[model samples]
Target: MKRTTVIGFLGSTLDASKQDAARWNKWRPTVGLCMQPDLRVDRLVLLHGRQHEGLAKFVTQDIASVSPETAVEPHTINFDDAWDFEEVYTELLDFAERFEFEPETEDYLVHITTGTHVAQICLFLLTEARFIPGKLLQTQPKRGKPDAGGVWTVIDLDLSRYDSIAKRFAEGSRTSTSFLKGGIETRNAAFNAMIDEIEQVATRSSAPLLLMGPTGAGKSLLARRIYELKAEQHRLSGAFVEVNCATLKGDNAMSALFGHRKGAFTGAVAERAGLLRSADKGMLFLDEIGELGLDEQAMILRAVEDKRFLPVGSDKEVESDFQLIAGTNRDLVRAVAGGSFREDLFARLNLWTFNLPGLAERREDIEPNLDFELKRFAAAEDTRVTFNKEARARYLSFATSAEARWDGNFRDLSASITRMATLSPDGRIDRPAVEAEIVRLGNLWAVEPEQGTDALAEVLNADAIARIDPFDRKQLSEVIVACRRNPSLSATGRELFSVSRQQRTSTNDADRLRKYLARFDLTWSDVS
Candidate 1:
């Protein structure tokens, strides 16, 4: 049979007092606990401070006399001040760690009837957090009956039981998810559900989490948010170390991930602690993980499995107990099939893989994200910019249309907004500005046909395209490409004529661009 076990701090004053012969029939909490009929406490672990040594001994003896079947063990966990939250919590946490627990055969109870109110709170917190796997039992004195035993009731801290509390938690989770996404309001039910699950896993587990998505799909942002959330909960203590595996190459890849000893390479410089050591007790975000070589992948698997790795040019091994969140834009399963990436490594990180959809897949989200980007631009540039009502509608309509291929996802949206905000004549983005932005995006992402690989094919009539000479068409295409990529006329001109703009004292780059556009009967809206 599974036996019930009780753990509590000894009450120095309440459980220690001896009653007179006339009032000897009085009931104490510790003594009353043993007297319960239904509750059979097989063993009791009582924690006491040095000042309460005598009281603890008396309480144990009294418990023994009351319930001879129950085994009592006294543990000394001294606290400098019972009222200090940190000191009391630390001591109790240490005690919980040191105490042996047999969960298979023994059920646990934390008696909150004894010790200071602070200690009781700490025990409740720990129990609720599952740091101490037990239920809480508190004894309350019966009204106007001190001689009679108090009633004991089990406290259930499960939030699911309360509807209102559960709703509050849901609301709080939504708020937390919003905060993590940099205040971007997410309306997609599926995406929101994914974020909720991510938050739960981030707080409750330290296992390797994998975020899979296309480039500019916010994988890095989400990884950083997970780190921030863990740090806020005090679950992680070290710095967040991020590395783009694609940027690391050859010997440098190994040296970057695992520290190298001095004289490990040709340079023979000072020893270096790599990204893994830098992420000890924290989080490591390895973006573009599929780009790592097979040998490096093997080393990463070992580090994740054993928390130990041998740095380059060193016989000794170093350890770092870090939580991993790897980001990849590639289909890792295909890479594994092709033998480019290790299957074992894939299996290890596949436990919590999340696929983030590209912008084209979530077009319904573009409207809000557009506003989010504008707000971000305002904050970054320290200038407020708003679009006119008509301009906003026009832009949103074009953005949500099939012609608008958001190939770069959020990054594309961000760059587009930055351009419009920077070029807005006043605080407001007008219709012309919106039109210019649309044309710019079209030009930048436009795919030229094999027959007519020129700027004239996009915005001009066939007659105009036919009239343009090959050399002039090439020049116009170059000008249009530069203008599409740049935010302002001056910026585009500066890029097109870097040396000429520097030497010509009387020349105006913006005027030069305007005259060039005029030659083809084009305006800024035509080529932007």
Candidate 2:
């Protein structure tokens, strides 16, 4: 049984990609996001909304162009209707139960989604693993079919808006293809850092840098950004070698990083040049570097340090003079102390490390992020959309006030915005529509956020940390309900934040979550 990937492209977003923007095809974005080429891809699943039968067929036709035999599995939910997490999850699980996973399947399990809420959640719930560990993609659907072809108009989400918050989704957590929207100072600090690092690296050896951050942060995108920001003289011939550490942890890890000699292991009947060697004279990014086992880490250290790693079963060391930039959310410091991570190796790699911040920290940055999200989501929804000031204020108020924890960081925010924009009533995202989104976001963190409480007080009590982890999505949902019930000062951040005694009524659930993800090793994708 060949393992096949399930690429999910939901509703209007997919339709627009086909009829308008190339991303509407979904296949390109789905397949494109996957940095791995050896991974076998079997099915391209299209989860179309129920109302957009025309759009569903439209996607099906385009997918036929990509994969002729693949069928379009279209399902729908009223985007305009207010729905809870369970409602969506249950439907998704029940709906996907019919699709059985074959044992012999290999290569891919890509779930590129847009409209089918049920299918996307179903895939998340029913996947063999607790959480499907792979790249999550969102393509900006074209707003409309351009009168002329090849216009290639694409909108980007500016993630820098959040104060100190953009860091959480950077590097290791690089998932989305955009930046946060926010204040210029903090975002400028980040750009300065990138420029500084690039200058320093180019000056010396121009070795590849390893980025480390949690899941859903924009690691890959950052790598691309680094490439973009690099001086053309330095960037030329210095390609970016991006590889997910999770996917390459085991046998694949060895073969992928180091070229293997023929009969290297049971599966390797033939010789193959691994990614590390192929990446020579260029950059090699070991994404999710924390996921690598001690032995694997040692092998990576050798490759990065000495630029010589042994091919399995061959005493001869293969030379790979590429600079290494590894990213991971796991606490390598802990791994080193536990004897799982080599202290020497960790020190060698820790020459420069940057930690990213989650969205809530810079609640003030939400508006820009919201604006950026709207453009991106609208294009993906194939419907132009905007948020009324009242709607924007209502959304920001609740969102900043809530105890919502987005475990997936910016990725979660991107997904939420995309879903809401596609479903906004009358294609206008007013305060109510945005509030509906906040509710949907609240569903992710089960804690009820007490309104009108001190925001600083809430952080002091660590309410935000309690919002996401250890609690299942359902539990977080329940917690949100609880906060809603209490709506007290403790429910909000207290004076812990500032010495100024006078306080403001704090927001709820979402803020708490943003705090938690930023703390500890929450930035790691696989870190629980």
| Per-model TM against the reference | 0.68, 0.48
TM-score for predicted model 2 compared with the true structure: 0.48
Model 1, TM vs. native: 0.68
Error of 2 at 205 (Å): 5.8
Candidate 1 regions off by >4 Å?
Answer: 1-27, 34-110, 114-135, 140-153, 162-168, 447-528
lDDT at position 107, candidate 2: 31
How well is each residue in 1-528 modelled by candidate 1, as lDDT tens digits? 999899988877667665454323666788778877778889988888888888777777777876888998888888778899999999888878877878888989999998999999999999998888888999866778465356789876787888999999989787777867777777777777888888888878999999987688899999999999889889999999999999999999999999899999997599999999999999999999999999999999999999999999999999999999999977677678767899999999999999887786677888889889888888898999999999999998999876677767789898999999999858899899999999999988775423235445555666887798889888787787666545568877776778877777776888888999899898877776
Candidate 1, after superposition: displacement of residue 449 in Å? 14
Worst 10 residues of 2 by lDDT: 148-157
| Candidate number with greatest lDDT | 1
Off by over 4 Å in 2: 1-210, 231-233, 236-238, 378-383, 447-528
